[model samples]
Target: MSLQVRIMTPDRIFLNEEAEEIILPTNTGQMGVLKNHAPLITALDIGVMLIRSKNEWTPLALMGGFALVKQNQVTVLVNEAESAETIDPNEVENSFTIAKTKLEQAEGQKQKVEANFVFKRERARYQVIKQAKKM
Candidate 1:
C-alpha cells in the first residue's frame, strides 16, 4: 500500500497523489513517513520535501508550514512551494546571492527578519536544485 500525500498552498492544492514514501523538513529535523507509519503532526521548516514513488523521487522546495500524518495519509500545508523541475538554477543562484547581500545590508530589525526569510527561501531552492540533480 502507498500513502495518500497532499501538498497544499494558500492559493490552491499543489499536489495530490500516492507516494511510497514522503520526507519532510520538520522543525526538529527531517522526518520520513511511509504507509501505516504513525499518527503525528509537526511543524515544517523552509527546505526540500522529497516524495518517492515507484523508485522515482520528486523534490519540492517548501516554505514554513506544518505537516500532519494520520491513517496512512500525509498532508503538507505550506505558505509557498515550488517544484524542483520548474526552478531555474541560474535564477535561484542569483536570488540566493541577492538575498545574502540584502541580509547583510539590512539595518533595522524588521528588514533583517524579512531579508532572513528571503535568504532561507532562496537557500532552500538552491538545495532543491542540487538534490534533484542527484536523483
Candidate 2:
C-alpha cells in the first residue's frame, strides 16, 4: 500500500499525493518512511527529501522545518521547499560561493554563526542540485 504524503511551505502546498516511500532529512539524520510506519514528529534540517513512487524518485530541496507521521500519512512543513526541476544550478553555486566568502570573512561570534547557517543552507542546495542533475 502507498502512503499519503503532503508537503507544505508557508506560501503553498508543495506536494500532496500517494507515495511508495519517502526519505526525510531530519535533524538527527535521514529517516526513511513507508506505509504504516510508526507515528512520529521530528525536526527537519536543510537538506534534500527524496520521494519515491513506482520505483521513480523525486528530489526536493528543503529548508529547516518539521515532519509528522501518523496512520500511514506523512506531512512535511518547511520554511522553504523547491522541486528538482525548479532549482538553478548556477544560482546555487553562486550562493554557495557568497556564503563561503561571508563565513570566511565573518568577524564576531554572531556574524560567524549567521554566516555558517547560510553556508550550510547554500551547501545543501548545491548538493541537491548536483544529485538531481545526475538522475
Candidate 3:
C-alpha cells in the first residue's frame, strides 16, 4: 500500500491516510498513483479524484490543485474537495442557473469575474452530478 495520502483544501484537509492507490484528475486527464509510483507532480483539473482504499473508491471533487507522489506518499493540495454524496442536487442546479445567467450578461472585467466564478461553481456542481451517477 502507499504510505500516505492527503487531499487538502484551503478550508480543510478532507482525507489523510495510507492507501493502496489514488486516482487523480490531472490537468491532462485522470491518472492513478500506486505505491512507489514514479516521482512526478502535476496540476489537477476540476474533476474527481477516485481514492482507492479500504476496498472502495472515494470520490473527491477537486476544483483545482497540484499533486505530488513520492516515496509512496501522495498529497493533493486542492482548491476544493467535497463529497459527491453530500451535495444537494437542487443546490447545484440552482447555482448553475445563476452562473449561466451571469455569464450571459457579462460585459466588463468585474462582470467577467462573476461569470468566471459562476462557471467554476457550475462546473464543479456538474462534476458532482456526474460522479454521483457512477456510484
Model 2 worst lDDT run, 10 consecutive residues: 81-90
On residues 2-99, what C-alpha lDDT tens digit does candidate 1 reach at each position?
A: 99999999999999999999899999999999899879999999998999999999889999899999999998999999998789988998999999
Q: What is the lDDT of residue 88 in candidate 2?
A: 84
Query: What TM-score quantifies how close candidate 2 is to the native fold?
Result: 0.92
Candidate 3, which ten residues in sequence have the lowest lDDT sum?
Answer: 117-126
Q: For model 2, what is the error of residue 4's alpha carbon versus the real structure, in angstroms, after optimal superposition? A: 1.1
Rank order by TM-score, top first? 2, 1, 3
Question: Model 3: per-residue lDDT, tens digit, 1-135?
Answer: 455998888988778888787788787888988887888989988776777777777676788889988888888898877887778877888877888888988998998986886687577766767766776
Best model number under TM-score: 2
Candidate 3: lDDT over CA atoms?
Answer: 0.79
In angstroms, the error of model 3 at 93 is 1.8
Count of clashing residue pairs in every prediction: 0, 0, 0
Cα distance off (Å), candidate 2, residue 23: 1.0
Q: Residues 59-98, candidate 2, lDDT per residue (tens digit)?
A: 8888989999999999999999887677787888999999
Better of 1 and 3 by lDDT: 1
